[model samples]
Target: MRKGLFFLCLVLYAFSVTLTVFVQHIGIQDRLLKIVCTLGILLSFFAVLAMLFLAFSLKGGVESLEQKENPAEKIPSKEKYLEFAARSGLSRRETEIGWLVLNGLSNIQLAETLYISLATVKKHLTHIYEKTETSGRKEFAEKVMAFGF
Candidate 1:
């Protein structure tokens, strides 16, 4: 809904700019028309500034929400992760992949770090999920945190 309003405002501003140009071209020469035309041109800059403000503000808000959700200032050590993985019943390879996952590595990064293919990384993740009894990454992370990691 907010996005729709933003597009609507942009379209209206565009129309206003065109109207300003057309009136100025026809040589209306009215003082009020000149004032409105100048304001219309100035509004383009205002619109761009408003959009930049919204983008940064929205990103900051999302980051705050994410921090509230995770809030892990320091990651547990490798030994700690291994202990957790052992308790979770992860195999050797699964433990390695799960450790990277806990450390916030992407699948490609995990594959590169482990010298495995993407398919192999995914397979190990599947096994990790099964052993941890979690359906997905987010659930697995939550389970790990709940396990006092």
Candidate 2:
């Protein structure tokens, strides 16, 4: 549908340009030719804009569908995540950071949420990584999920 809209817009612009050129060559009165060209330009502009809007909307729809198809990507329960973190020997702050990380929060967001500095967030994340035996957010999250708490 998006591709069809794009092609339709292209065809409309091409036809308008051809008509404008032909009208000029046929020696149409200046006023009529100007009006025709102006209308054609406006039509082409609107067509292109509509096509672009549809294309972007369609792309968003596809992304939404993909998310719906993958249920496992959703954030896990807080209790379950916290349980796994506790079992891993993480400190109180490290466990909190681990839960945020599992929920897909960035370091900046974690800092803001916990009212701590970015450096502090990083330090906690490092400790969480060490305790969980994982290198980064992705690995940590996978390991936490695999615990089946």
Candidate 3:
């Protein structure tokens, strides 16, 4: 949500800046238009700057929320897990499911969490094991845990 707001602020800033510049160009020959355009440009510039400040102020809160939700630090060596998962050609979806499995979610639970069928979850697990060179769920979980994610 914070990210969405930050992006929205950025988009508004870009749009305001662009509109102000375009208006200024169009008002080059009209005194009244020039005055309005100049005011608008100044207002937009300040608004954008203010929004940028707000966005920066909100960043730390967003980061802390992200850390609280995922706690990658607690998980352990997340960068290495990502590298290993990438090299193994595990799709993004597979990696997410693997994380759930490592956290000890049942197939039904995984299905509910992922909004997929149990069979689909099972299928993904099969591919996960094959890609990770593990024989079963237990081994896969052990491997991921070893990586700390």
Candidate 4:
């Protein structure tokens, strides 16, 4: 897979180079050189990015293999994550709201689910986002997923 991805990137780079040269040789005057250069630069940049991606994927594979060889070296227990979340100033109510938010509930839906007023549900969500240092629902969801909750 890695080699296939590498070859794809190389082909893209070659195509970009060919396009650039073709434009220069064709002598078209209407900003064609600028367009070709832009394309070439973008292709080269993406080629480098693809290479970095391949390196990281290979490194991750190696690390997973090493972990299989020595599982005892893994980090602390799962409870440690919950403890960390608590220490990070997220209240139990906020955590509940986070879970509801992750479940695709709007403030009205959340209010109906929890038997609360819509205004109160919004208030709780505001507090939850504030405590979690998240600005929006998507970011809050990401944090919840990060905590594996």
Per-residue lDDT of candidate 3, residues 1-149 (tens digit): 66676677677667767766887766566777677667767767776777777777788777876766543433546576777688788999998887777666799999999999999999999999999999998777667667654
Q: Candidate 4, which segments miss by more than 4 Å at Cα?
A: 1-85
Candidate 1 has an lDDT of 0.78
Which lDDT value does model 3 have at 10? Answer: 70
Candidate 3: stretches off by over 4 Å: 1-75, 146-149
Q: Give Cα distance to truth, residue 83, candidate 3, Å.
A: 2.0
Q: lDDT by residue for model 1 over 35-85, one digit each (tens)?
A: 888887788667766666666676788898777645344456677677889
TM-score of each: 0.50, 0.54, 0.46, 0.41
Q: 2 or 3, which is superior by lDDT?
A: 2
**Candidate 2 displacement at residue 49 in angstroms:** 4.1
Models sorted by lDDT, best on top:
2, 1, 3, 4
Name the candidate that leads on lDDT: 2
Least well predicted 10-residue stretch by lDDT in candidate 2:
67-76
RMSD of every prediction: 7.2, 7.2, 11.3, 11.6
Error of 2 at 115 (Å): 2.3
Candidate 3, residue 16: lDDT: 66
Q: Model 2: per-residue lDDT, tens digit, 1-149? A: 77787788878978887887787778788897789887887887887788788888888998998766443465577777777877899888787777777666799999899999999898888888888888998888778778854
- Each model's lDDT comes to 0.78, 0.80, 0.76, 0.72
